[model samples]
Target chain A: MNDETLSAVDVRDAVKRYGDFTALKTISLSIKDNEFFTLLGPSGCGKTTLLRMIAGFEDVTEGAIFLYGDEIENLPPHQRPVNTVFQNYALFPQMTILDNVAFGVEMRGNSKAEARRRAGEMLELVQLSQFSSRKPSQLSGGQQQRVALARALAPEPKVLLLDEPLSALDLKLRKAMQLELKHLQRETGITFIFVTHDQEEALTMSDRIAVMSAGELQQLGAPTDIYERPHNMFVADFIGETNLLEVSVDKIAQGRATCHLGGGHELTCNQVDDIGVGAKVHMSIRPERLFMSDIPAEAESLKGTVKENIFAGTDITTIVALAEGPDFIVRTSNSDRGNKRIFEPGTEMYVNMEMGAGRLLVD
Target chain B: MAGGAASGGSATTDTYKDARGWLLMPAWSVLLVLSLAPVFMMLVYSFLTKEFRGGVIWEFSLAAYDQFFFDRGLFGDDPPVIEWTYLTIFWRSIWQAGAATILSLLIGFPTAYYIATRPENVRPVWLFLITIPYWVNLLIRTVSMKFLLRDQGPLNDLLMSTGLISEPIHIINTNLAVQLGLFYSYLPFMVLPIYAAVERYNFALSEAAADLYANKWVTLRRVLLPAVKPGVVAGCILVFVPSLGAFLAPDLLGGAKNFMIGSLIEEQFKGNAGNWPFGAAASMVLLTMVLIILLICARQQSKAGKEV
Candidate 1:
């Protein structure tokens, strides 16, 4: 075999600085071969900067990067084996679609005929074979995006960097392109490092995601690992919707802690590190995890008054006002809402939750 | 879009209301008086017979075109020979204008790119500096160039002082001086349009080019140049058309050694020849040439309308 391990892209303590303002802090991660990895964050979170560094557009200020298990920290963009699909789909306007797609291969010293043939195959792979002769200006936004993808893939790069390629499309088009991109990744088996701010897009396509914020990696895990068990408030709030309630630890034993909610409801939850008895901590709960009941079926249920009920097509959200804490939101599917009636305003009800629905965060 | 119709006016016609047609009358009348009437008069005068002095006779004649195309003996009885004099003058003018255009492009393209790449606030200062010399009259600038380029001027003095040359290089009253004057006169025309095009260029395309394995030079040749070609063509036309008909540069810097089209036409009307018909014919030919260049440029630009 091979002398190298499974890493397709390895970033080691990368740092990027412009004068004194650091755009990316020390970030290290190893992307597995053929894995659809994502760098997800809000705008200005240094996610695109990291992707640029991988594609060799931006120099690494302090650390090293390896591509396909070979060191490429000093390689220029043209010499590197990684290619990027730009956010705006920067297709050459003067060239036909086939020529635009063939450009990279021709630049790599391939014959014009060979590059053209390879480009034709790539266009067919993207289902744009009929548009090969048309200029990029003649194509629509979604079509140009596919052309950009085809152009980047024509080089047969070991690692493909996509910088928010689907953001320019309408919602329906974005959704369709998402599925197409996933299928493309599977068909090519190329290591895809996608950068996006859309968490839903990341969760839907990425095999694993690295969540970044303010130049630091907050968490890196699979979608369910991140959404079910967030390490901090930022990741929990960013990845998906969650309600954080402040609770004080009453007792701790056997890796479990007894906590008192702000409304004087006592509950026991799985313990988290760095918490002492009587210490205030944050508890996160997803809205879909909670249910409404007229009669208390469990002693741990919290009693509350119905504040407002909101209907949002597929799901109905019921807001519950506690005696001394923030309002609790309970979500149920409309089908479930048919089985369970929405309590009218000012009616007292018990809010029940299943086990592991509430997670204790250190911060 | 529907708001305009809801406002109770005829929105189907657009913002140019029917009543506003009267507002365009002053501009149209001025154009007809200043442009159309002069061109019409020139066309009529070009076909009429030339008088002894500067006036044109009402009788039509082919004498002006024949005089331009054929040369006669001193006694006016020899068989007509093809006259290459005016054609040579016109050819030289075209050559000089083409050289000046190329020279300005060589200098202005880099200057424009430099200014366009600067920080947003600092760019205006550089553009202002470029326009500062232009604000002064063109004649004054040409005269100043003559002063600076003369044999005993500061340029030769500085070169001699630096030990680069033992003897002062003679640049005054030569074709080189006229070319330099023309380049200086219209460099701004080249710089401004290219600056606008470069400013509007998407830098992401450059990055994408690099990602697609293009080095800096290849990216510029294949992508950047093609994207900004319309601006380059506009700059060329702006410089070349004006340079073709320019009289001041050749007169002031070229020392009147050879006849250019402008000077030949000037001689017919104002110099010793005083032939109004020949002057009008030369003017019509030059006007037609410039119009053809402009029409070709417009058709090519509209054929593509810009890539993106």
Candidate 2:
């Protein structure tokens, strides 16, 4: 990496174990300065555990963690230059909003007046200065979340760790605060390591996402890279909705693997490494990537019967069952002109997957 | 039609509320009769004069109050002098109770914290163990302390055998002994409420405080202490009020040196003092003080509740 890409937090072979259970396997990743990095996974996939390790709330059982190139594994939580927005916001219930925001600054040995001034600035940043005198319970969930963010930022820590801060809000409020949080992160230029099990939230806000499963990192890359070019079965399936079709590899040429979808229908996918001819693999194709057509197009296509047609508000999800293969789903956007044709069940349709849309998962 | 329906709905709600209130009257009356009636009786007795033998004269008099404040003149020429004996006893009772409350808190908080931090599966077991003291009668427990602390008791014998002390020390009839007894008796009250608070506490707040660069002590002050304040205050009140008027501990542990308000009332009513009116008067004073403390606590709890 270049000097400009110096790591704000470099987690090296970090492992967390609770007695006989290993919550996080040896995991290594470097979060860049001022980057919005998200640890996205299902619950118990160790995303929160890794975030806690970086926040110094958890001990690294067997590896090191460096913050700004300084080894911080042995440091106590108070000594680390990192803060966490807890899952529940965890605002001091006894204190006013102003006092809650001022707490971190005061803890850093600032005078009460000085801390109040900075805390006021943070509250203003979060657009909560008007509610400074109110207690945390007086505010709504979104308001409390902003206060938590402001409070964590008041100390000006190098890294900010958010543990599902928006999970408590309703869907609409969560969507709105997602953008606000992204904008705040950009304005403050703080490296954010956000943890969430919500993949859509991760895809919406994260600059890069580290997808994890079963205590191991499945993939670490930009959102589009993880979404469009997932490295394995877990990464492909976990990050978004996908249809995993079992296929047999027939040949390899020019970085593409020719695979036989059952019933002699041939399809070629951009091949991942370590799979040779005659190997069984699952071809991961996103539901949105499959195109439905009345007539077979020039690309590789399979004839299947329409199993179910689901009319969602924004998209039409058509599930198709191949004559010799498992069922697959194709999602197409709804058009305003209202001239789109809908295929009923038992109708014969050609399912076309564009070249490079499918990833061969050998795992 | 909407207005009429709305009025009818509200009328039904009003009748329902009235019925609920009427149903609660029996319980309220029971509380008034069982709890307040004795206090009201004591208030009446406090104003009456002591009879020649033992009963009250029913004639309203300030003799009890006068006896509390003034010393009788042994000679005809000398005027009644202001005495500090009863006042000293009263003040001593307050401070000793305060000390016991503080001590109980000091001991209870850590025990509660330890129990709270234990794994969820074992928490109920620890709580059960803490409450095991309640299963034994407090008198037996207090008397057991006498056996453990007497000069030739097991504690002193063990200390002497370990070469920690050369001679047996006297600790049975001192104010310290009374405090120990009170502390032992009321510690559960302190622990249970603090444990309840700690059990409900979101430890994430402490972690957030620490993550904000607060050291351990600062985290305790800013996060843990304030979060558990209601429980601490409750524990203090529970320990303080009863310790202030403690009769058994002072009687059994302190012998005669310690005379709290409880013992003073006991002395006036049935001991050699044999002054029923004076005992009632002292009981009234103690009740007033306790009521004031209770009011302050109620106000504090309400304020804390609102803040939360």
Candidate 3:
């Protein structure tokens, strides 16, 4: 393939405007072949709108989308070579499960025998062949979801768009289907564009994540890169729980900043950009990265009093009040053995950080 | 004492179920007086001997049925012949009712769809417009329709002035005018049920079909029409049953020339040949045809319901 067709989907400066209000401001992204890409954000953040535009349900208001070097922005939804597993499944209530899956194949000019044969194979792939003759209302939600997946995959489109397919499932079923969906994508080797509002699902299933907010892309990278090195405050705060501390830079050297916290506590953390010396900025550190320790570990430690400890199943969380800076939270694995290391309330302790644990968020 | 009071309350609640049989008394009386009694009277009177003017003699006879199937002659003595007059009238009534139902379905489906797809606040206004004409009496509406369809009416005047037609066509006393009156009278029945069904439909199913390579017409045929079929059937029944026995449309609009079943039954009693038994017999046959149609519809619906 040539360079232009190397990527499965290439979106350039795509903008979606609903009347006077802009839903997506000039956004651009590239999805590679066989890659599981996720668009993650809260509701009304334009993630679903972008997915619909790719599926041709929404028109391209400004920019172009190229699929395999072909501009398909003007194509109607039925003419586009893409399919979507809708959020509500949207299975035809009047059709049998087998007929629902065969509908796409028959509409694409296949014979009845051929369509039914191919539909059978797709239903087998989704492990729902036993429900071939049943209506959609007769099946359970999970079974109906599988039927929807089979129907969308029957056409074997170039890209499969999933709009929160597992949002309607229970917690345990959702956890199970997450793995199933990831395995299905890998098995089929089709480019999958999944849209979801769940941060955890995005982190667990997607090879790369695009975090969006307020009609714009906040950050786009691999899950680890997005989690460990957020580009701004919004991405860091939106992705997961993080404690953003107020600190003033004293000096910058070797891509790290020596900053000062209150109560004469000094620390060195990785800096995202050169903000110059003595400038006040916010730095983010994960709660799991900080731990209670006895060693007064030189320049990467802070002194605080233990305020509370909450034991939550597998992990114990401790809230500590620093001498002058914001209160800090520390999480540690729980154990059954008795030990004196766990501190009670009003006990003064030193909180130590691992190397390269905290990074500066530049906005 | 507290336990005794609680038991008393429980006993009162339990006795409510036993007293529930009285709740159906009004319905039972309504069925007996309003429906079953009339039908039973017609069935008995159909087989009785006809008197001279407008009453029946209390004697069991097949003369009414014999008058229907084997017309002796205009006089008293002749070989019996197969009666084509009454049979032709029934067939005409059936054909006209079927055409009116089909016409209403064609126009009603699209109108209901348009009203359903509008914004929620404007939908009631459109429905009000559709039903406003029906608020007038049916007799007045039929008379007004006759005036509009006459040769010198505004419809012909507008058509002649527009040069679409060089002459005023006679329509007021035709079968076409009768069908027009029936369609106008019962169009709301067709539109309302379909509108309700379309309103309850999930549009995401249409979107899903479009996503899976089905265009607009294909989506409507395969997905939408099948889902709203119950409503369509209901609308057809509502329009067809009443149209089968309508007298006003065929009388005022059709000029009393061709006798529909409604007019035929009416002529037996109110016209110069006042045969009450014959009228009652015709009513029984019409009732039987309607019962058969409703039974067929019920069977179709039950069969459809079992698939789901």
Candidate 4:
């Protein structure tokens, strides 16, 4: 029996520093074998640094990294079982695609013939077998990206790190590559650690994601958990669109709290931690969960005036302004809008939502 | 009211434009005149007959050109014989310069690479050190090398004191000494061009090569070398051209047996063997040789740059 735990990459309390600047704070995570893990963050949020560290380009100042259950923290990049596809897709400009792909294997003491044969196979895997003799400069952005990916995978690394590999392409191409990469990861069954600032890309391709901010890991969870149940305001605002309304707790009884809005609307929501009656808190409701009504609903509804209306594809988004708080937005299907009629500017509208749809967060 | 139209008339405008164009004629003529005068004078001197009084008489003759190719060294076989000395010196100068250039490129490349990879705040300081020796006179630097290499100098003293040698070595006044001086004098020139080239290096390419399974040496040989060839070639040309024409280092540090073309040309202008016409002919030949080399280097650089 192999008896290995089967997690492809394991990082424990990883930290990186450059003189006085700490580029990566203490981070710990375990990526399951063949799992598509993503590090999502804004620029300079240590996503690229962490990726470099995994690829052996950057040394971990304080941490242990394990690959296939073997400690690889002190290993040099060329000795590590991980390969990185850089953001710029750093394909060797002078060499043809075949030589570029064969380079890693050639370094590993493989004969030229064997390396070329394996490189040819990898090019076929990436659907670019015909471009073997073409230089990287001759290829398009997407083609170059695939070549970079093929080059990294030619060595059959245990983990492949992609540092914003799809960012250089056009929007349409980026979307296509994202899907292609996901399929490629599944086909190869190698753990892929993708780093990007694009939330949509992370949510679409990752099995799990680690969201970082200012060199610190904010939250690490599955994509749905990160989007639907973000731990803090940063994650909530970062992952998707949300409407945060400042409200005061009117009363609390049996795992339920009554929130009083400034616009004279009262609502009952599921109980959140560390809240008392008359204490201020922020209520978060996703735009898709809010609905419009002619009259306020019984349990969780608020009154406001329609400030703006947008006809988005497949949905209508209405921005409603309460008398005392900021503007609130609600998105509903255009078909649903036909029944209740989305209001125009200056029209008084009652916003309705399920009590379970609203989440209260302490200030 | 009619004065505005009269001033803007065709003749007035035509003269106004012509005046601006004509104004630059003298400056342009002066530049052309200044650049062509020495070349024309040198060509005239090359064909003139030499007078015993150390002057040339323009009698329209090729005697000086003929004599320059047949001239002998101050000390050689057959009492300053003609055959083999001139051709031998010509080939030796090129051979020495080429070797020194290759050595300089080898040493300067990695130094430049390291400096280029340094942090922005420290890069300037490292570059400053490379350029500091250049501020001193080249002759002074060449002369100082003798002190560091002479029989009683610290290098020999240390080697002998450490029992690594029984007698002081004969390093100073040898072909090796000339090469050492050539390499040192031209090292900074080589380094700067390479540093400029390497400063633009993208680590992405090496990482890409690594992912493709290239080990360190393979990456350097296949990817990095081609990427930095322009700088390497540029440095080679920078070092080789000047080293070819170097006179002081060979005179001060090299043995009397060592002779470069520059010293040969200089000897004609000085000593009892002063022959200005022969020297002028030789100088013209030397100038042509340098021009040919420079043209070739320029072509090679353009080709390398286009590849990148």
What is the C-alpha DockQ of each candidate? 0.54, 0.67, 0.65, 0.42
Off by over 4 Å in 4: A1-4, A127-131, A247-257, A261-264, A271-280, B1-44, B60-82, B158-167, B284-308
Q: How many steric overlaps does candidate 1 have?
A: 0
lDDT of 2 by residue, B1-308 (tens): 99999999999999999899889999999999999998899888888999855679979988877777678743336787876788788888998899899999999999999999999999999989888988998889999988888999998899999999999878899988889989998998999999999999999888988998889898898789988888898899989999999888888888887878888888777744478888888888888889998998899788877753
Model 2 DockQ class: medium
After TM-score superposition, the amount by which residue A2's alpha carbon in candidate 4 deviates from its true location, in angstroms, is: 4.2
What tens-digit string does per-residue lDDT give for candidate 1 at A112-177? Answer: 999999999999999999999899988999999999999999999999999999999999999999
Give me the TM-scores of chain B across the candidates.
Answer: 0.87, 0.90, 0.90, 0.81
iRMS, all models: 2.2, 1.7, 1.3, 2.7
Instruction: Score candidate 2 by TM-score against the native.
Output: 0.93
Candidate 2 chain B weakest lDDT stretch, 10 residues:
B68-77
Q: Residue A262 deviation, candidate 2, in Å?
A: 2.4
* Among all candidates shown, the one with the greatest DockQ: 2
| Model 4 interface CAPRI class | acceptable
In order, what fnat does every candidate score? 0.77, 0.89, 0.77, 0.57
Tens digits of per-residue lDDT for model 3, B184-262: 9899999999999999999989999999999999999999999899899999999999999988899889876645788
Docking class of 1: medium
The superposed Cα distance between candidate 1 and the true structure at residue B297, in angstroms, equals 3.0
Model 3: per-residue lDDT, tens digit, A25-117?
Answer: 999998988899999999999999999999998998999998877888999899988889999999999899999999999989899889999
Q: Chain A only: give the TM-score of model 2.
A: 0.96
